[model samples]
Target: MEKRNIAISLPCTGEEEWQATREPLMSGWLTQGPKVAAFEKAFAERHQVPHALAVTSCTTGLHLALAGLGIGPGDEVIVPAFTWVATANVVLYCGATPVFIDVDPQTFNLDLEQVKAKVSDKTRAVIAVHLFGRCLDIDTLRAALPPSVAIVEDAACAAGASWKGRPAGSLGDVAAFSFHPRKSVTTGEGGMVTTANAELAEQMNQLRNHGASLSEEQRHHGPRPYLLPEFNLLGFNYRMTDLQGAVGLVQLAKLDGFIDEREQWAQYYCEQLSGIEWLRLPTVPEGGRHGWQAFVLYVDPAKAPMPRNEMMEILQAKGIATRPGTHAVHMLAYYRDRFDLKPDDFPAARDCNDHSMAIPLHNRMDAQDYAYVVEAIRQLG
Candidate 1:
């Protein structure tokens, strides 16, 4: 295999995406409009949920979910330290304390046992992030939590993934999904919140669009045109644009095909890298369908002849792009200073954070690129 500059992730867009954008542009209603509503409807249908609200990004969706549930100061939200910073940051956005828990070594998701131990009187909710496109043990987690505690699924990476024949977004009280370029789908930048509860869905819709009881589309289409709207609660301008929604509709149509390609690429990686004793491939549990958002390999520095950083340098020098696993949220300066946390607080998260690396797993990669990445790994070993 020859050296090549393979990116870790890339958005696969083509003529269909361009056409979607063109049609929305020609409509002259670029803000939240019919396209956004159609995207929300289609997304909700795909996830088997009753309602879906399109937002600016997954971060805002999480924030809206928390706010809609009235989680605020004096409340504690349990989250995984192994996830992206936004997972923890959303808790802070709600003025709630984010209690970080270590991740399971095998699944790279929140450790259920640790979650059980972290619950307290102030613990109002648990934000379960399905890390690296792998679904968490939602049933087990739900059973462990007290009935009063709410479960919010941060399904940013596990959009099309499932657990026990149930869709990822439908497992929790509310779920947030991303349409960023790095994800399986792209809307330039957009997100959706899905829920089965009509009241929660309505509240989330209101919270995402400046706390208005009705959106512009509803007001404009109604008999009353100049009536003043009611502001029941505080909210933010987190609405997705019609253009983004149009692109999202097209991307959603291709999601299954994209996921199929990702699964195939992941299988190739597992097969080719199995012989590398120092590397640990990601594990997908039984009854779980992973979206393969990222093909992460854990490099055991103790067993590997080369250090993790050295192997990364070697791979980069060979023109293969890679990335460190998601940041250790507890160790980040903001969280550390705020919580006065030490590395010892969450050993598993710290260990995984230090050693894990993400390889290229985009839908665009062909057999040759996959072979090159495999060869690069073998050379590192």
Candidate 2:
């Protein structure tokens, strides 16, 4: 097979998304109004949650979740050292200390033992990251946590993913999902926050819209023309626009289909690439319905034909794209200096940060693309 370029991810969007935007465009209301509300409602139903609030991005959604939970400067939030920087950044956004912990090497999820060990009187929350669309055992984690501590799910890569039989949004105290182009669902740049707690949901609603007592839709329909919402708390302009909402609705409908296709190809990788002893393929853990956001592999430098970075370079030369699944936040500049962190502080996270490689896997790719990637990796052996 001829070598060809394969992107790490591409949004599964087309004319349907384009046409969906028209309704929002034709209508005069363009802010976070009716369309956003409808998207939120549909998202809640899909995720089996009572409330789902739309936000500008998952980072903002996380901030809103933490803020809604009343975590502040004096508090500490436990986060897996291995994840997108936003997971830890959101804690800092709330002026809370982010305590980094190691991850389980195989699952790339947080180690519950480290989480339990890290908890203290100052610990207000633990951000359970459903990395690479594979959820960690939330039930076990929940049982381990104290009643006072909250669970804020960093489900950036988990949309259709589940723990046991429960969906991502329903497992934690509050969950944030991404709809970035890289995610299974795409609304260009948007996110949704889901929770069962009514008071927390209410607080997040206000927090996403400048702490407004009434939403724009409510204010417009109200009889009092001069009344403005009473701002009781500081908030951010993290509202998702009507255009994104309309597109989000279209993408949300196709989510299951997208994951199904990706999962099929992911399993193909596992079957075809198994003999490369240096390569560690990701798998759907028991009871886990992975959303298949990306098929990330752990390339062991010790036994591989070349180092992970060199392997990526060879692929890049052949018009294929690859990326490290994500970085160890503690190893990044800000967290490193601020906390005096060393690269080896969280060993598994450090190893994953250097070795986890995300190969092409998305709704846009076909069997040809999957086969091409497999051939290329096997050739490296």
Candidate 3:
């Protein structure tokens, strides 16, 4: 194995972040403080939503969202089988069953027909993930889903993505976003929950900070600054630190440029790989403005010269890194054994788990790196 020169994912942070983080560290007020409030305000304004509560991670944000929705035992939450397991795991945290459904074979998004088929009286919500930064069809979901069931957009990979000119965070009833290093904008490790409903937003706000009726900043800054806060309900300590908030401000400002650079690189990948008959490239649906978080491709094993895993191995040997797009949640041991699920139950999802490949697509890559990835894959023929 040679020394790898290209990375599959990288955070494109610069002096702005270093300079921003200095104040938070120096001030000695690192918990959710002024910086966190500023970040929340900026994020809410950017998404055109009334509320945005910063959290420790997207996983916690999803948990808080489901908890806020009052989804408990016996309720079912429909999840796409082809996403990161966290989307479904949160339902488990709420003591609810996660009903797995197949995604569209082409777009790799939630299949509305499958969703309609799965919804029942016990259905409480649906977790619509914007996988790889492409916005799922919210309009069709709005029209098809009954008012009794809620929609939670897992916009983990979608910061700049939009559908019909509306931002991803604002499209669904409530949304959760990630600012992990791999995301377009990063806070090292942080998440945000956005919603138009004041009641849900207030509940989640309390739920993230030990169920406090008043935050530390609120209590310390008000007229009765010495008073301790009240804990009204059960909550988790999922608050984002001021350090991350400071970095988030810098990253949020750079998000659009990051997306633009990623889109350009993605187009290059598409153009260079277009002639390869064995590759199935990603597609942007009619109204979807892709954020291009990651460039995922499907390798048809029957048509390709090698199998998907073999192709990944070959790429790895060439000093290029690649990964499966994501796992089929149902096929994982816990879900399979717990629910008595089989791999063939959701054919499209199983095929995706076996064949879908995520290659290098990030702001850190240059033309030379892109060329190497394309040439390496082309050689597989």
Candidate 4:
């Protein structure tokens, strides 16, 4: 029989996405306009937040969130060492130092205990990442941090995920969410910042549109035709196009269905791979809901007869795609060289980076494909 190719991650798109695009194109007003505003409004309402500002990407959203908080030079922002570089890069973007903290081995999120030790008078905020679609225990983290320190969630991988019955984006003071192709829903390349704080939301709104109090489209139709909007702060052109917004609106509607399908696939993988001593399946904590972004398994090289790299190669030959769980931010070349850090500094993150591998868990997978993956792993044993 011919082998079937399995992708580690694939965006779910269909007629709805195409219809969304067509309508936006026919509207004529393409740049951040009614469509974008409606998307932001609907997103905010979905998350039960007061405001949402759509931007170019999650990275820019984080930057704007940090800027809105007035976190700049001489400040420190705690970030997980095991997440994407964007989490820490935003801190640097604001002229603040990113204080790296090791993640919990189980959840692959910032360790709450470690977060306490890292806090200081200079600590301005903590960028808590809901890694692999699992929400970090924000209540515990909030209890650990000083009252003055703001908590900004890097919920890039979490769309419909929740913690203790609360939505992911609403758990923190401000949160950034991604709409990248791999996410549960895609806007091609877009992001949104959610917050209940009115001032922060207003600031983020201005920051995303070149520091103008009113966006150009809003100003054009206003009575003050000759009045130029005031620029209160230095900002960036991080506006999301109307086309992306239209697609996102349609995608957001299907987010619950996508998450449900992904969870079902995850449960199937767990059932098939449970007895394999060499592999550690992903876990969801009590009272928490995971978005099931990527089904990651940790390969124990000692128990497994084959090495990690060898296993990856074998899987590739079998037409299965795999990827490393997020990078160890502290050990990345740029951060290591710039900060003079070593892998040993963050032991847990280092271990996670070395052993974790992500497998396919998209909505399209069926039982046969999953069984094939399990049998391949059994062969390795």
**Clashing residue pairs found in predicted model 3:** none
Per-residue lDDT over 92-170 for candidate 2, one digit per residue giving the tens place of the 0 to 100 score: 9899999989999899999987777899999999999999999988988988889899999988899988878889989
Candidate 3, 318-362: lDDT as tens digits: 888898998999999999999999999998999999999999999
lDDT, candidate 1, 1-381, per-residue tens: 656888888999999989898877886889999999999999999899999999999999999999989999999999998899999999999999999889987789999987788999999999999888999999899988999899999999987999988988999999999988999998988899999989998888888889999898889789989876799978899999999999999999999899999998898899999998988999777987898889888888789998788888889898888898788988999889988999888988998888999999998888899999888788774
Cα-based lDDT for every prediction: 0.90, 0.91, 0.91, 0.90
Q: Which ten residues in a row have the lowest lDDT in candidate 2?
A: 285-294
Positional deviation of residue 102's Cα in model 4 after best superposition, in angstroms: 0.6
Clashes per prediction? 0, 1, 0, 0
C-alpha TM-scores of all predictions: 0.98, 0.99, 0.98, 0.98
In angstroms, what RMSD does candidate 4 have relative to the true structure? Answer: 1.1
Better of 2 and 3 by TM-score: 2
Better of 1 and 2 by lDDT: 2
Q: RMSD of each candidate? A: 0.9, 0.8, 1.4, 1.1
lDDT of 3 at 123: 96
lDDT tens per residue, model 4, 16-112: 8888888769878788988898999999988888899999999999999999999999999999999999999999999999999998988899888
Mark the regions of model 1 whose C-alpha exceeds 4 Å error after superposition: none
The TM-score that candidate 3 achieves is: 0.98
What are the runs in model 4 whose C-alpha is more than 4 Å off? none
For model 4 the TM-score comes to 0.98
